[model samples]
Target chain A: MSDSPITSGMTGKTFRVGDFLLKEWEPGEEERIVAAFNRVFAKADPNFRPRSLDFWRWQYLDNPSGKLLIHAEAPDGSVAAHHGFINQRLLLEGRPSLCGQMVDSMVDPAYRRGLQRVSLSATLSNSFIGHTGGEGARLHAFYWGAPVPVAMRIGKALVQYEVVRTQLKLSCAPAEVRLQGASGISVEEPASFPEDTVEFFRKVAHCYKAIAVRDQPQLDWRFVRHPECRFSIATARLGGELRGYAVYSHGSFDGFEEGLVCDWLVHPDDGAAANALWAWLVEKARASSAERLTAVFPETVPDWIRFQEAGFRAAPTQYPFVARTCVRRFDPPWLRRNWYYTLGDTDLV
Target chain B: MHSRHPPPSRTLAIEIRPLQKGDEASLLEALNAHRGGCVQQGHALSSEELAWFLAHPSGTRTLLAWEEKEIVGHLSAARHTMWMKGRQVLFAELLGGFVAISHRARLGKRGLFARLCREFFSEQGIDGDFIYYGWPTREEWRLGRKLLAYETIRTQVALTLSVGNAAEGLPAEVELMERFDHQARWLWDRCAAKFGASAIRDEGFLNHRFVERPGYDYENFGVRDDDGVLRGYAVFRKGQWGEETKGLICDWLVPTDEPEVGRLLLRALEAHGRTQGVQQLFCLLPEWSPWFDSFQRAGFLATDAERMWIARTSARRFDVFWLRTQWFSTLADTLIV
Candidate 1:
């Protein structure tokens, strides 16, 4: 047995797991990559530590949307590690949230000689001929804990940290949604949101200093999926062309602090118009036996104020943060200027 | 990889027997019999905890040991089926995993495991593809290394938060109203216009949470401007309450710009008990929410927080679609940490 970490290489190269050629994994290697990763995991943790093989498969390789599985191989061409995303999805409300999940990512430690980087991008193309594919994927965040600290002199990372608590509080009132007032305002069933509303939102604030959401698909996908939400919509016609409208979504939280107004929005900052619309809807919720209103408000906006005035309180959720560095050498000079492609991205990615 | 092979020194026998209809009395007697007897140290589980463990779906596997005619040791485990990794997968956990001291040196663990694995565990598996991942977390790392045949995967934290009643569930100023077809519709619209059309409350989504609708207290409330303009509103639905009909704040909205307005609405909510005739408010706070601090400042005591992880059976990125259910969170309304 060799005492050194380096094993022998073949093909005029030093990296080898016996005799197969070593190469960066690509799309065609999905099955081999997934197999290798799972094999390595099976050889490591079998108590479902981070996830089970089934979990990694579904989340990465077997995803209904299809994915690319990256693999590192031995000189003999045996697969080593299965690393990378299963598929990409969107997170509405803000940011074009592209996501990449590491699945069955492992290495055959005995075969280690260098080269542990493995990746697999899904089917989406970044460019075909001369067109952009709007790729929404990233390989930055990882599931395991953070990197091994920068210095051994840092005293082995001694910090008396405490465990953060999480709770879900329910309102004591019956959540029966009822409206009690009779307003002269004509009510039309809320329609698929029009672009003007986003435009109106732009008028007040610049989309929270993130990527400008200047389209329809993103809006429809985000707010539409959570259907149980109740919405109050009022249309104000201006010269036969609808200029401004108010939209309120019925949202709730169970098991947090109390069910809250999860989301609400009124176009046209005119306090009177939005207020009138708010009054009508609040009366309805009051009549409907609602305990409280719920909304997802950003740090910016009158939402925090408006939500409170509407008889709702704020609640919070916390997620443990862990980070690691994969690149042996890192530099971001190229990404500095392309705000959209560089630093201007969402966490889901 | 080097494999460690130990010569077989002991034979293990495990017997799975159905619980007799009148096993309680016998079980109680057995427990009492062991009370004075020398059992393994640090191996005692409270009767209540044991009962709770046996009540869940996961606590199904129980193995009794017998040498000749005397019952010496036992092993207990659970079998559960749930939505994991985006699909349904069966999970087996070794809980209350114990063995008799006398049987320890004789390969008791290996025997019990081999027998159990023969009964409930399977080696062949596929998650769209063959995966052999492992980890080295302080808790589960040993098993993977012990198995020797497995590989290391990633490690993560499993988290949770509990839901319960506040010291006061409802506000004293709360009043319940009926859903006005047009007004509720208008509020829904305003919310949609302001938030987006996708936010309006609907039956399918609401009903998915619990069994019924219109069954909660503090059904709804409205805060209007002095001039009769709708300024704020909240809706409550019934849910798992530590006390009476819990107000699940389904929705809250106001047309102002101050965090205090949210506080005022919270104050109004705290006073709404008179209307609902109940004593609590409840809701779940996801880790991604921004108002966790606000709820704390407003006097809502937190119950617990736990890490969150998901099991996927397919190849798809996890965004918000994975709403995982977790248990045993230390969340309370008042705890600051």
Candidate 2:
């Protein structure tokens, strides 16, 4: 009944159960949370992939020490419910302030009746979900649903709110194409990428507010972090002015044709530039012997138009999923969806 | 309104207004007051996270409704850059929206949302090229797709894995780094060198961000060829947000592009979890990513994956031709097209 030292083998106790009492998630539980998260997302994701537990560790717990946590307990104190509140700051409508995100709420539904302790853990997570509701219980899992109504309400009230919108788009797949040699447009792959490509991207990123631009750090992290993408940069020039560019990458991934066009780019408006660049890309992609373009962002980028118009039809978009978080909200909003192609989870700038 | 389901006459007053830093305390307080009814969503506010939220740019400019200044309802519209058909477009997102318990049915929130939308579009020199939004429910998808000037709306799902299962016999060819020792650290640089410059390839980066970062274990494994040359590597770790430990196969690099190799990497993970005391594991892959095929083969039942939304921005409005043709050779020839 109290936050007292839980004794082992205790019965008739409503909530308390040994050291592993149900409590909201907090900063220190990052490891435990990551451990449980592996189980949580297995059923939800096909790849059940993780870029790095450290990335998540920093994102969910270490970074967002700002978030609150809660968990369920057992008689001898084993974590039955690793459930709780997650809070973080995010930009809203061009304004910066604390934006509550509802995330990481789970219950072993099969053991739903094991103990009211689970319910107690659900309430514990809500302790912070009511973040904006100051003096309220934490919200459980608002963006996503919760196991119980009580938990759901807690999660709901804490979130910034649900925006009823759909912005996800499907990318078209590549079609059979033949590249013809074009004149005047010197389209040659750079022998070596400009060292400043990352810097160039940093400056170029300010152009889109719809998506977050990749800072030098993020670029370095993704492209430098992994070697999955075979990235190369190309440019078109006239009158000594840079007219357009393409940063394409070819990579091999499982579950698809051997080689894939991981990335391709063409400006949204400049037809000639876009055309030249795309033709070059098609020719180049063909040269790579790529059966598919896996690294492509469907409609997320304006270049998608050139890709589709040239015959790339709908190939299922890669690694799709909903974004939910009340925990570990990143500062500065690095992972902007708008310019995802350039975002470069890999292949560098 | 078009599709009526249940709960005759929803009752909360849904107001939307610009949220300020000071609003965190009272907003959370009000939410706590309605703790029982508010259970369907969110974690309650805390002082520390509240301060952090206020400090982040995304948390700024959010609109909060006043139930007499009690912080009953809210709609946070976070703006960011995105790629739309290959050009930069400033996207105004409707994120983190919520209504107070008493403000439901009054259309307070919708009205406020509409007002924000109109004002945003109408602003003089608004400095944005496009707008888009992502939603959690069908009603949401329908609303944004129908009312807004967006071209496409896609499905989103989430996938989970339970580490409780025994995944034995995953080829143990890959070895997890014991610690970020000099040898291990040297491999990181060698692995990073393949990407070359323009990459944030640095020992400090890996050490700080992944290897030594708190809450993350550097269970980085690498497979060697006959010569013991590291040909493939996978950095798998447990990611935690709340309660469950999620076994995430975060990054994997292989010398072989074989399906068997991919399967083997997964097998290595399956084997890894068993020894690490992992009860279950799941990683959210990009929903449409074929990479998940391996996970499915490995028996991870995927579900609940959500859509990934993006907004892109560029200094100059994204001009597709400029973006594409600059790279596409025919684009130059097709100045005529």
Candidate 3:
């Protein structure tokens, strides 16, 4: 467990877990990792796709936030388990901080029994965040959405992980949507996130203890330039200054058409702007013949009140956002009150 | 307006019988007159709406007590089905049980309400194996417990959060759907096994309970992975629960196998709630619900008052602990809350 630099070409630190060896991913392990991922997940899901090296490279090597890839090697030199974290810049209490999102986690079925699964997971996580200096020292937290039950249990019991919030689904019938537009605001579906929109987000970022930096470039990369999924961006301006913006897409579910609001941001003080943006979206969805419109938000989010007034209902499905951090202290009530999240921040869509 | 026939005299003998097709007028009059009861306090239903209630999909049968042609007492038996263990069990919910204030004393000695309960239970038995349940007032609950061996399972409490100032949001990547899909059905299959007892949340049940519900409009939100596999789903509506203007989380399912899905979906709901301008977000979860931790983490505080989830099982045994943990009852499941 050395705090040594882990570069693509150089062999980094390694740990022994039972007879298996856990080490940082090297330069040429994409094929082995992909093969092991496909093999493990194919058993769980018959339709699981075999990811290509390009997709892997796009997600890992090309990510703006640096990637931390760890794999457990068996005696045969095949990958037994894989765990990775993609770096993200976050505003923690209005100050810039480094965080990571845990992703691409899997273990070979052969070595998943007893404590090996737990050991491999813990060893990899510890190696990434446990180092004392350099890049590891700069890491404040690692957050992820929707860990399977077993992972949640193990992380809570063994790793002191805490759940940040439970995601709740809410929906509204397009035919029943009613909203009073704000007189000062004008809304338009923009082709990209404008600079004013980014500035508006920055103005409101301090309202939450933690949030992703939603600048123009990040927004462009996330919603506009995403490889899969096409999102429609709507921006609301008051006197030509960006007050709020929303991202959504139209799709059908179970034979019923719907507009899914993927992401949204409104100034904490701009109730009128939020209303105008919502009214415009509902009207847009109705114009497109979507039977209903839906969005996902945390239950504690105050903005949900506006959606409810606009006729949205809470759905029964929910997801949990969990976090594990050594440097950040999340006071339960405060964390519950201030953390801002949206359907757009995760990889589920 | 011209006066109708005078009110029934005290000496008139009361006769109880199955409600006939022409009873809608009399039933509406009786319901409107009894404004003290919970059902009567809400907006009065029109004749068309009354007919819709009597013609509920699962089927509803009302038995009325008449005093020389004047309807004096009324009770309804609404049939339903619930998932117990892994099977659908026939169930019935009693609704609109009441007697005229002047006729109450005489009817008690004759056991009018008790007799109606007996007949309804017997009728359910003749139809199929059934569990008779209801949300009776405290007085009625006591009477039923003494007379029909009704058992109080667990009291369901309303959890509320003043979300007016909370600043949480939904994860942007998780997809929020407004309709049920194959992925939702898949998620239900993956998530349903953890519950000890619940309504069958399959596509048929969802379509009937939410999509096809009369009067109120409901929407379903489905969360899926990138591969289009369902992780969880929720049913919600915007309406008043008692006096509060609230967004109700009627029913939701995220697999205990994937608690993180529950977190993400719940957060998404909160964000939706903010945009809707509800005074509060309300959810009905049993104290022992596995999702209670998630709800609490999202800042939902439980109110001091609770509603009883009472039932009369065919086995004639009351296992309160099992009912507390196994029974997945929400406000949406009740005939009237």
Candidate 4:
């Protein structure tokens, strides 16, 4: 169980932390890593089920964009801490860039007991942050969704993580939402988006300084091939031209039936299309006997006002989106307001 | 105490009294009329639906401002047992407060809201450590603050994130279920200490608040270990938010020490959302929630707007900061949401 050479398909660079060995994850270390995860989290969470090797493989090896996993091992060969990131492709003003999503951060409870000369949490985080843009790693920025206060404190102290914007949860009863007329626009629930709709999203995406690339393949994987949920897509057209599209589903909240509007994209200048698409969803939800409907959008996003116009009331909770960039420095105030984000951009749903 | 104001031109003597049993029909009519004028979409609730509030186990009492036989203004106070500072205390929540459009001008001038506030507060004497509270609209909040001396508690912010392109995959070992089992009873006891002040989430409360709710289908996801022990759980629903389908996680229970349980449940929820084609996921957590890091790591961000949790204590004067820090409130805690 002592620190020994382990076989791995992907060669990873190693670093030293006191008596612990910190390095990128090797292929043969999945079981050991999973064991560490279970040991640290199982008693804390009674419902914690041990992750399967296949799930771990799919997350790290079979992901379309690949991932970066780093683990810290004690002198006796037990995992002390683990930090990893999955690669993501983000379009910044129509230009593609590599982004890293931080995930699966864990620290062994024993090592986390007290502050010492070598802080395991700080060391593990610093190793990943420092190595993000070095050698084989090409992450332009690191982004995280609703990070806990502890992570935010650590991230702010270590890597200058900044809060970008908060996601607002706006809700309303489906029976209470009145649809306003949008002249020359019609809504249709399509099984799959047409080619024109994809092109329309591309055109709309270019209007934002930052947005997820929603081309055909990305859209198909996001809305269609999602592993757990099914979505209904509605497209708005004017004179047979794609103007906007909305994705929604029906479910229950707090024992009450509800309709959720997950993602909505429309031409930047086409207010009518946005209105038409929203109204159509309301009618659809009402017909399905949904008691209420809810949506989450960034406050800075223009869609917030549109949603308010459509009778969505604000819920009392919000999440702050944080990010760390290695390549560029931009005005924080401007980026905070101009960035386009929707519920689709986050993994919470 | 009925305050007889100087009659402004009309001879209509307004009588304010506790709502009686037969007042249900008139109250319903008044509520529907008020809703019809204000609400653009939702229809009036049926008498049966309205009866639930009147017959609530918490004991609902409405103070109706009547002009002769017709109801002019309505305000209801429902009793709720709240866990505060490691103790259970009775509190009253003011809900569905409205003044008829025809009587708005007169009521505003006569200080009808102030009168209602005084009466409601007086009704709960110093004998019980009762707290009067309400989730009023902006205008109503302002009015209540000015007239009732209601202090602002913590403003709850709705955190949201796009589930699109956010990893929807969950670990295979975690089982996501739709209903709660016997193990859930101990969940509140295990986590209650962390929440200094919150609703008593016992088995009965869980069943009453979520399972037995009328006209709603709530899905509960219980996170279990390999041995089928409940570690954490989350209650959520799929609903429409504007034009997109959204998954709303209403109530979440994970031990404070195990923040990862929240993370695991959230990831599993995202996987569930993917199956439903939910474009986004949202949950309402306090600004100072212990699990904020889990939510942040899960990709939820704070929104610019916030909703307030305002209150006024009838027993004594309380510090706003103490109330804010100790109060564990959520959308599910209130009947309005």
Greater lDDT among 2 and 4 belongs to 4
Instruction: Tell how far residue A129 is off in model 3, in angstroms.
Output: 3.3
* Predicted model with the maximum DockQ: 1
| Poorly placed runs, candidate 4 (over 4 Å) | A1-12, A25-35, A49-66, A74-78, A113-115, A133-138, A148-160, A182-198, A250-258, A283-289, A331-334, B1-337
Per-prediction TM-score: 0.30, 0.34, 0.51, 0.47
Report the C-alpha lDDT of model 1 over A1-349, residue by residue, as the tens digit.
0011111110122223334333433446555665666566666667643344444444443333234344445555676433443333322224342232222335566554343332111111111101211222222211111111221111112111111111122222323322233233333335555656555544433323222232233334333432234444454434433334544443433333323332334432444444455554555556655556444433223433443443444343232112121221211111111111100111111
Pick the winner on TM-score between candidates 3 and 4. 3
Candidate order, DockQ descending: 1, 4, 2, 3
- Tell me the tens digit of each residue's lDDT in model 2 across A1-349: 1112111111112334433354444446566656666665675567886445675543334322144445665454444555433332222222222323344555544344664444444454443334423211222112222112233333434432222222222222344542344455666666443344444443343444323222323333333333334456566654544555565556444234433443333335556665667676666566776665443442434554445445443333222222333433321112223323422322112
The TM-score of candidate 3's chain A against the true chain A comes to 0.83
Q: Model 3 over residues B31-88: C-alpha lDDT tens digits?
A: 7787422233366756665765666556666778788767777777666666667676
lDDT of 3 by residue, A129-169 (tens): 66521223245455454554456556655445555543445
Candidate 3 chain B minimal-lDDT segment of 10 residues: B35-44
Total backbone collisions, model 4: 78
Give the per-prediction TM-score of chain B.
0.36, 0.48, 0.80, 0.83
| lDDT (Cα, 0-100) at A169 in candidate 2 | 24
Q: Supply the DockQ value of model 3.
A: 0.02
- What is candidate 4's lDDT per residue for A1-349, written digit by digit as tens? 0111112212366887677787888779989998888788786679887766765675566544446778888888989888766555556656655455566777888888423665686787676666564222235444555555556556655555655443347677876565767899988887776777557866787777766555554555567766556788888999998888888878643234578777889866787898788788888787777777878766667677567656675643434466765544432334455567666665554
Give the TM-score (vs. native) of candidate 3. Answer: 0.51
Local distance difference test, each candidate:
0.34, 0.41, 0.65, 0.65
